[model samples]
Target: MLRIILLAVALCLGPIAGAAQQTVDQPSSTIAVEDSAERDAAIAVRIRNILAELEGYEDVTVAVTSGIVTLRGTTVDQALAERLTGLVARVENVVAIENEVRQTTDVVEQLDPAVERFLDRFRQFVTYLPLALVALTAFVLVVSLGFVIARMKRPWDRLAPNPFIADLYRQVVRLAFVIAGLVVALDILNASALLSTILGAAGIVGLAIGFAVRDTVENFIASIMLSIRQPFRPNDTVEIEGDIGKVIRLTSRATILLSFDGNHIRIPNATVFKSRIVNYSRNDERRFVVDLGVAYDTDLVEAQALALETVRNLPFVLKAPAPSVWIEALGDSAVTLRVAAWIAQRETSHPAARGEAYRLCLAAMNAAGIEMPGPTYTIIGAPASAPQQAASPAPAPRQPAKAPQNQDLEAQDVGVQAEDELDEMISQERQEQADHDLLSSAAPEE
Candidate 1:
C-alpha cells in the first residue's frame, strides 16, 4: 500500500517542477526584450536632440530600432541630409542608418527669415535717426571750427621758414582737429564699438598702403629735410650724382634743375639727399687748374716761374690766394706741371679767366723759347743707325710783357644779373597768399 502512494506523488511533483521551469524561462526572455526596446528609444531621442542642435536641421526627424537609426524629413539640401546621417551614425549603440531626408526649394520659406532680419534692423535704425542727426551736426560744426583754426597763419609762420613746411603744419593741425572731432562725434552717438572696428580695418589697410608707397613716402620726407637744411639755393650751380646744373626750383616731389645744355632735369629728393653734392656757387672764389707738359730737356724751375707770372698778371685772378705751379709728374718724353690759380667767381667768368690764363701762358712760354713737347714713339723692328746729335739752340731774347698797374678785381655784371633774375623768380614763388592776407588785413579793427 505504501509503494503505491509514493508512485502517485512522484508523478504529480514531476509535472509541477516542469511547469515552474517553463514559467521562469518565459519571464527572463521578456525582460531582455523590454531592456533592448528602452535602449533603442533612448538612442533615437539623443539623435533627434543632436540633429535639432545643428543649423538647417530643425525639421529633421530621427528613429531607432534595435541599434539601427533612421533619419527622415525635409532639409535644405542633400548635403544637409548626408550630414544628419553622418551625425546619427556617431551615436552610441547605432549600427547603421537609413536616410530618407529630401531637399525642398521653396523660395518663400527661404526668404522669410532674411526679410524678418532686415526689417528688425530697419526698425532699430529708425529709432536711432534723431541721435544720428545730432551726431552729424556736431561733427560738421567741429570740422568747420578746425578749418577756421587752420586758416590762421601766425603759428605756422613761426614753425619754419619754408612756405611748404608752414602749409604742412597747418594741414597737420587741421587733421588733428578733424580726428579729435570725429572721435567726439562718435562718442556722442554711442558708436565707439563701430569706431573701434573701423579703426582696426583702417590700420590694416594703412599698413598695406604704406608698404606699397614706401619710396614715395621716403622722397616726401627727404623733401622736407632738404627744405629745412637748404642744401642748395636757387640758381646755385650744383653737381649731384654727376648731374651738373643750376637749381631752378625745389618742389615737393623733385628738385628741378636747369642743366647747362638748357635741358630740364628732375632728380628725386631722396636721391639728391643721399648723393654727394658739389656746389660751385657757395664760395665766391674758385680755383682753376691747368696741366702743362714741357720737353724733358727744358728747365722745370724756369717753366714754373713763367706759368705763375702769367696767371698772376690776369686781372680776373685773385691776388690774395695767389697762383701756384708744381712739377706733377716726369714722363718718358716730357715733364708734367700743374698750374693752379684762384679767381673771384662772382666777379669774373670762370671759363673766360681760365682761357685768358692759358693763352697768356702759352704766348709767354713760346716767346721765351720753352719747348712744349709731344709724345715720341719708336718702331720696334727698325734699322739700327747712329743717333745724330743736333747743335744746342740759343736762348730766345727776354721780352717781358708790361703788367697792368691796377690789381683790383673787376666784377662780372652778367653773372650778377643772372643771379638776380633767379632770386626774383624764387621770391615770386615763395610769396604766399597767407602772408599777404596776414599783412593786408587792417588789424581787424582791434
Candidate 2:
C-alpha cells in the first residue's frame, strides 16, 4: 500500500514539476496571455467573490476567464439564466457572457412546431408594432364617435342634430376609418395587394349576390333615400296603409312603431315607401269637419247655432281661424249640416277634442228640441188610398111599387123566380173571370 501511495504521489507531482521546469526554460513570447500574474490573480479573486455571492441562488453557477464571465449549471429555466447573463453583462468589466447554462429539460424535445410558429408570429407582431398601434387607435376613434353622436343632439332644439342621422353618420364614418386602418395595417405587412386580389375575385360573386338580392338592394337604396330626405322623424304619428302608430325607430330594413296597444310593429321600409303616409303632426294646425243631420222640420237656425257653439268651445279648436257652419244638403228625411273648425297643436289632443265636440253638439241640439232624423219608409198598399163609403147612400131611389104582389102567393112566387134566374147568370160570369185571373197570376212575367 505504501508503494502504491508513493507511485500515485509521483504521478501527480511529475506533471507539476515538468510544467515549472518548462516555464523557466520557455520565453515569455510563448505565453498567449500578456497580463501579469498579479493582475490575473486579482481578476480570479474578484470572479470567485461574485460566484460566492451567487452560490445561494438555486441552479446558478458562475465562472470567469480573464475579464469574461461564463454561467454554467443545470438551470430550472434557461431563459432566466440567459436574462441573468444579460444583467451581469450590464455590470462593469463583464467583457462577455458565455451562457453555458444548460436547461434541465431537453431543448430539442421542448421545441414543438406549434411553439416555433407562435414564436415566429410573436416576432412578426413585434416587428409590426405600428400596425397594432393603429388598430388600437381605430378602436378608440370608433368609441369616441359613438360618444360624440350621442351627445350632439339636444332634444328641445328644433335644428339639433337628429339622433338617428347622427348615429348613422357616426357608424358610417367610423366603419370607413376602421376599414382604412385595416388597409394600412395590411399595407405595412406587405399584404394590401392580397386584399385587392381577393376583391377582384369576389367581384364576380358579388354580381351574383346582387342579382339574387335585388329587392333587398332596392330596399337598402330606399332606406338611404328615406334617411336623406327625412320625410318623417322619430316620434311622429303617421298613418300608412291604414296602419296608424307612433314611429319608434328606423333601421336599414324596416321602421319600428309602437302601436296603441303597446305592441311593437316592424313595417318594412319598402312598404313604407310604397304606401300613402298621412303625417298628422306635420302641420301645426289641422281642419276638422263634423257632419250632422237633423230632421227636416227642425229649426235650421237652432241647429247651426248649436253646432257653432259646440265647435268654438272645444279646447283645441283655434279661435282665430273661426268655426264655420254650412247647410250641406237636403235629403229624404233630414237636412245635412256641416261644422268646420280649425285646430291648433292638433297632435296634443286630437281625438279627445273631436269627441267632445261631437258629444256637446248632440246635447245642445237635444236641449233646443231639434229632432234628429232616423230612417223611415212609406207603404204604398191599397188600404192607404182606398175611398170611404156612406152608410145609407140616399135611400137608393125608393125602388118601385111591387105592391100587392102576392095578391096572395102569386105575386111572391113570380118575384122569387125572376131573382133566382138573375143570380145564376151572374155567378157563371164571375167564375169565368176568376179562372182567367188565376191563369194570369201563374204565368211568367216578361
Candidate 3:
C-alpha cells in the first residue's frame, strides 16, 4: 500500500514538472522588445501624468505600456471611460487604446447608424456651426417678411379666414427657408460638391427603383392627385367601383373606407381614381319617384290628388320642385301612377321617406272614398237562376210505327220504343241546325 501511494504521487508530480519546464523555455514572438523598454517607460509616465490630471474625479483609473494605453478601473459609468478614450486618442502619441474599465453601475450602450449619422452631422455643424446658425436665423426673418409681402399683395377681403390654410402657408415658408439655409450651410462647409454628387447618385438609384415598382409608383402618384383634386373628402359618402362607403383616410398607395357595417376597407388609390365615383352627399337636392298601382275601378282623379297631398305635407320634400304625378300605364288589373318629389338633401334616407309617403297616400285615398284594389277574381257567365229556355210549345206525340211482332191494324197501339226512336231523330236534326247557325254567326262581318 505504501508503494502504491508513492507511485501515485510520482505520477502527478511528473506531469507538473514537465509543464513547468515547457512554460519556462517558451520563446516570445514580439520584435524590438529590448529597444522598446525605454519608450514603453516614457509612454507609461506620460499616461500616468494624464491620469493624474484627471484623478480628482471618482471611480476612474488609467494604465499605459509603450504607445498602447489601457483604461482599468471601476467607473460609475462606462460612457465616461469611452469618452475619456476618445479624448486621449487625440493626444500626441496614442498608438492604440484598450478600454478595460468597467462600470460600477449598470449602463446601457446603444449603437445605431442613425444615431452615429446624427452625431457626425452634429460634429459638422459644430465645425461651421455658428455660421449655419446665423444663416438659419436670418433666413427665418426673411421668410417672415416674404409672407408679410405676400399677404399685402392680396386684398383683405380675399384673404382666407381658414386657420388651417394660414398654418399651412407658414409651414411652407418655414420649409423653404430651411432648405435655403441648408444649401447655404453646405456651401460654408465646403460640402456643396459632395452634396451634389450624393444627390445625383440618389436620383439615379431612385429612377431605377421607380421603374422596378412602376405600378406602386403609379398608385403613389394617384394618391397625390386624389389629395390635390379633393375628389372626395373624409366622411363623404361615395360609391366607387360599386362599393359604397365613407372616406376614412387616404394613404400613399390606397384609400381607406369605413363601411356602414364598420369594416375598414382598403382600396388601391389607382382603382379609386380611375373608377367612376358617385358622391351621394355632393348634391343638396335629390329626387325620389314613387310608383303605385290602384284598382282600375278606383277614382284616378282622387288618387292623383291624394298622392300630391301626401308628398306636399312631408317636411323633407321640396315645394319649388313641385311634386308631380303621372298616370304611367293602364295595367292588367290596376292603373299604374308615378309620383315624383324632390328633397333638399339627398343625404337623408330618401327610401324611408318615400315608403312613408306611400303609406300616407294609401291612407288618404282610403279617407277620400278611393279604394285600393285588392286581388280580385271576376267570373262572367250565365245567371245563377234558371237559364232562359227556347220559347216553343211541346211537339205532339207522333203515331207509332209498330214492331213486327206487335204490329196491329190500329197505329194507336204504339209502345214506348217507337216514340223514343222518333224523339232521338228530331234531337239529332236540332243539334245539326244549332251547329250550323253557330258557325254562320262566327263568320266574317262582311
Candidate 4:
C-alpha cells in the first residue's frame, strides 16, 4: 500500500516537477557592472530556463557570446525552430539571435512525442471521468423530464383543435426539451460556447432539409391550417378540380375523399388548400334543370305553360321558389326549353327529381299532340325521283303512353333518394384513420 501510494504521487507530480526543475542559475543584480562574459552567461541561462519549461525543446542547446545568442539542435518543426529566435531575443542584454535548430526527421524521435501526447490526453480524460459522468446524468434527467411533460395528453388535446395538431404540439414540446437539455449539459461541462456551434450546424442542416422538401413542408403547414379552420367537414359533398366526392378526412400529408364510384382519392393538402372547392351540401335546397325540345311548329307559349304546370305540381318541387320554364335556344329541328325547379335535396335526390320532371313533361306534351321532333336535315334542291307538286296532309295527332290513370301526370318517390353508399364509404374511411384525421364535423366551416 505504501509503495502504491508513492507510485500514484509520482504519476501525478512527475511531469510537473520535470517542468519546474531549476534552470541554470542566473547571476545576481548589478549586471550593469558585469563584463561582456558575465552578461553573455546571464543571457544564456535566461534563454535556457524558458526553453526548459516547454516541450519539444529538450534537444535544443543555447549559447551566448558577446551579447549574441545562438539556438542549436532540433525541434518539432520549422515553425517552432523560428519561434526560438523570438524567445531568445527577449532575454536581457541579448543583441541578436540565430535560430540554428532543425526539425528532426528520425521516425522514432517523432513518434516518441506523438505517443507522449496521446498518453497525456488519456490521463486528462481519466481525470475528468467523474465530472463528465455528472454532466451526463444531469442532461439525461432534464431530457427525461421533458419527455414526461410531452407524453401528457390532456393539455395538448385541449390546446390543439384536432388530433393531428395535438400530436404536433407534443412533438414540439419534446424538441424544445431536447434543446434545453443540451444547453444544460453543455453548461455543466464548462463548454457552453460549443452549444452555439451545435445549434448553427443544426440550423444549416434544417435549412437544407426544408429546401429539399418544400412541397412537403407546404403540405404540413396547410394541414395545420386545415385542422384549425376546417374548410370542409367530414361527409361534405364537394367538387374539387373537377373531381366530385364526399370528404373523408384531412391528414397531415393529404386530403382523402370517397369518390362517387367508391374509389379513394388522395390529394396532397397543398393542392387541396390551393384549389377551388365547390361544396354542394352547404344548403338544404338545391335547384335542378332539365332541357326538352319541341318541334318549331308547336306553340312555344303553350309548351312552356304546360311544362311549368307539370313541374310545379310535382310533390318534391318547392313552391315558394316556384318552378320556372322558358325558351332556352332554337335547335336544328326544335325549340329547346329549360325546366328548373328547387327541391329539399336532403329528402329528394336532384337527379331523381329532374328525371321525373322530364318524363312527365314529355308525356303531357305528347298527350297534347305537341311534336318533339328529332334532328332533321334538308337539301335545298328538289329530289331527283320525287314528285314536284304535292301538298302533304297534316300529320295525325300523336298518342301518349299509358298514364297512371288519374295520377299519371306525376311520378311518386320511386328513385327520389340517392343511394347513401358514398356516405357510408366516407364514414368507414374516417374510422380507419381517426387518429390522424384533422377534420371535425363540429368545426365551423371556412
Cα lDDT of model 2 by residue, 1-446, tens digit = 99999999999999999878654412222333554555545644665466456622355656656655566766545565555654555444445456676666756535553587799999998988987677567656665654555455453223323333444565665656555655655665667787777667779889999999999988877666555556665455678778777666566677766555556677777888888888876777777778888987777987898889877876667887899999999888789999988876433355545555666676667656677766566655458457765555443433222223122211111112432333344345435543211112122221
- Report residue 159 deviation for candidate 4 (angstroms): 2.4
Candidate 1 has an lDDT of 0.74
Scored against the true structure, residue 353 in model 3 reaches a CA lDDT of 62
Q: Give one clash count per candidate, in the order shown.
A: 0, 1, 0, 0
Off by over 4 Å in 3: 1-204, 296-299, 328-333, 346-348, 368-446
Winner of 1 and 4 under lDDT: 4
What does the lDDT read for residue 91 in candidate 1? 70
Query: What is residue 373's positional error in candidate 2, in angstroms?
Result: 1.2
Q: Which should have the higher lDDT, number 1 or number 3?
A: 1
- In terms of TM-score, how similar is model 2 to the real structure? 0.44
Candidate 4's C-alpha lDDT? 0.81
lDDT of 3 by residue, 1-446 (tens): 99999999999999999867643413222334343656766766666676676732244555556666676776554566666666666555555667677756433223343466799898987877787677667656666665664455244313432222333455566666555655665676566777677668879999999999999989866765665566765555678888877665555567767666656677898998899988866676777888777878877887888888777877667788788998998876678889998875433455566666666666666556564554445557567697887778855654322223322222121123432443344345446544211112122221
Against the hidden reference, what TM-scores do the models get?
A: 0.66, 0.44, 0.39, 0.80
Cα RMSD of all models vs. native, in order, equals 12.9, 32.1, 29.6, 14.6
